[model samples]
Target: MYSNLDRPPLNVTELRRGLDPFFSQLDVVAETGSTNADLLARAADAEADRSVLVAEFQTSGRGRHQRTWVSPAQAQVALSVLVRLPGIAPADLGWLPLLTGVAVADAVRSVAKVPAELKWPNDVLVEGRKLCGILAEVGTTGKNPTVVVGIGLNVSLTEDELPVPEATSLVLAGAEVSDRTTLVRSLLRDFASRFTAWESAGWATSELADVYRERCATIGAQVRAELPGGDRIEGTATDVDANGRLIIDGRAVSAGDVTHLRPLE
Candidate 1:
């Protein structure tokens, strides 16, 4: 069992003290169902873009395809940011996952001193084991047309505490530093800058593609993409296009869960 004895609860006062200069809103709750769900529901009244919502515990946190993500209390970082990308075409919104993935990989590597690679579209991995999962959702019904990007990072969980066999944590990955506050703050800063540049270009450039490609582990791997409707595609992942779709065997797969497969002997 992973004891959170050494991990202190996140102090909003301390977070605001360090993050206020760059962020307009930084909130942390003792517990919640999901930060993304909370922020999505509150987006209409949100003060501005980049407003962050973090929860120490989630009763029903979810990932892509509605998979539940339950982490040990205080042993991980569950956070979501409300980014308002008004007027950006819905078609280009697919980039949100890749965008956030790049930010996470960069920030984690910088702070934790552990090499992190992005598994196309979202998952963040360290040494081929998942260290983080990202979920991006766009509000389609309300007047607030904002994107909620949620990240769940395993920080201090022990091997016994891991929810799945393929998952990892910063502590398990041998991170030189494993402070959640510092890592979250750094991620916000990196995401903000990357988003600023991408937004200013009116979603018309590949300014982020090059960097995402460099950090993506799926680009040159043999993979299996399990598509919706019980169909699957197996091929070499060649690249991710400007719209963030995985190009496998000359097919642009916009939505699917890709599994990396071992190369044949």
Candidate 2:
């Protein structure tokens, strides 16, 4: 499925070639309108099982809360993967983003040589600054559940290119910002390996739970979750449930915007 080779140059070709042993199908786009958009459109026509879309630049990228994600051309990794989950209940869909966040934390740790942590539902943080953003979208099309996991990572962006004040890149965090292709390749490989395990044992397996909790930045800390209903719940972050819900005090928070109350030492 190496059809988009004519676009531009990327170092991810080597990474894709290495990943050939794991995935049966792969697709890389030099520049796309948006990887998520392209995959969603294709999912409407084809099964798109285990297919990946990697874009060098996205003209219109989106994140959680439907916020726009900004990136300079070739300055970040915008990737999406389409998978078909059969017999999975709609209620279990929330775990996909959490699974993705863990996968990303694993990948970044492997390549960046730094410890990464998960901020609630689907954000990756390094040194209390955002390093990655994950958005998982699920829909039932013709009785089959299609899940698109989109990941946007700040790889080599300069300070001026950052869209927000709190964003940080690998280079800024004292990690070398190598070729975007290599980083994306490593991410997909790590994610595929973890995803296979998660699918086999489910999210409750000790291995998955331990890893997520170890990398989580919110557990055992006081935090405030901003709910859509304009209600704020303040409590000590307890744990993350098997279904990827954030456990605050005794309540299972399925969705909200969380802000850690105290700084980590």
Question: Which one wins on TM-score?
Answer: 1
Q: Write the per-residue lDDT of candidate 1 for residues 1-265, one digit (tens) a residue.
A: 2336688677777678778354578899888999999988876765657789998888899999999999888889999998887677777887887889999999999999999999988899998899999999886523336888999999998999898999999999999988888888788888888888888888764878888999999999999999989899999999989788899999999998999998779
RMSD of every candidate to native, in Å, equals 2.2, 3.9
Once fitted onto the true fold, the runs of candidate 2 whose alpha carbons sit more than 4 angstroms away are: 1-9, 141-143, 202-207, 263-265
Candidate 1 overall lDDT versus native: 0.87
Residue range with the least summed lDDT across 10 consecutive positions in model 1:
138-147
Please list the C-alpha lDDT of all candidates, in the order they appear.
0.87, 0.78
| Clashing pairs in model 2, backbone N/Cα/C closer than 3 A | none
Tell me each candidate's TM-score.
0.94, 0.89
Could you tell me how far off, in angstroms, the CA of residue 61 lies in candidate 1 after the best superposition? 0.7
